[model samples]
Target: MTVALMWEARAVTGRGEELLAWARAQELTPGPMRRETFRAPQDRVLVITWWDADYDAVLPELPDPGGELVSRAAHRWRFEPVPDPT
Candidate 1:
């Protein structure tokens, strides 16, 4: 099964771009199969990574971008896709 890891953060006022850039530059060990990033209003950045692993497998997460770039700690979640029936 493949698992999707979602990481998100809300940057401090006027630091959205910096936070986004920092997120974009991160390198995860044992890299995922694919990754996508998004920006939302209220200075939010979201990153989704797809990995070829079981839902309960441990995976590397994005590191903190530091207090200077964000208002609070980041948030993360893991998801496994529903099985396909044919």
Candidate 2:
């Protein structure tokens, strides 16, 4: 089923840029078909996600056992097609 991944993470100040760079650099493998980021009033979240070629098709590429100061919060939402708004 077509779906989207929503992930949020927090790190020390300056870590945001570092994380973003790392994420972009991961294109050496099963890279993200696309990704984006946003900032909130009181939180910094890294929104790493991509198109679903079968959500499970990319599970193995995920980090196993997390990383130092790199925590993750992920949720999946299925797509709901809508008629053209034209």
Candidate 3:
């Protein structure tokens, strides 16, 4: 099933530019569905939404990019699929 993964994580100060540069490099590949940045009150955070052909396809590497931030971060929320209301 085609699954969409939405992710948000705290970003390292002064490293935002570096991070974007890295992300640009990865754009050459065909994966990331969408990326967005926002301000968390005073902290700058990045949020991303990606869809995969299979749920498991994107599950494996999530920890490497997400759980391994410079300091530590938390996943605020997650959603899968919900049946439409008739």
Model 2 lDDT per residue over 1-86, tens place? 44445555554455666555554444425545656655443234445556646645554233322355444443334332356898
Highest TM-score model number: 1
Model-by-model lDDT, in order?
A: 0.94, 0.48, 0.45
For candidate 1, write residues 1-86 as lDDT tens digits.
89999999999998899999999999999899999999999899999999999999989989878998999999999999987898
RMSD of 3: 4.6
Q: Each candidate's TM vs. the true structure?
A: 0.93, 0.46, 0.45
Clash totals, every prediction? 0, 0, 0
Listed per candidate, the RMSD to the true structure in angstroms reads 1.4, 4.3, 4.6
Pick out the ten consecutive residues of candidate 2 with the lowest summed lDDT: 57-66
Per-residue CA lDDT of candidate 3, range 2-38, in tens?
4555444454655555444443343424555554544
| Clash count (model 1, backbone only) | 0
Residue 57 C-alpha lDDT in model 3: 61
* Model 2 spans with C-alpha error above 4 angstroms: 39-43, 54-67, 71-86
Quote the lDDT for 31 in model 3: 52
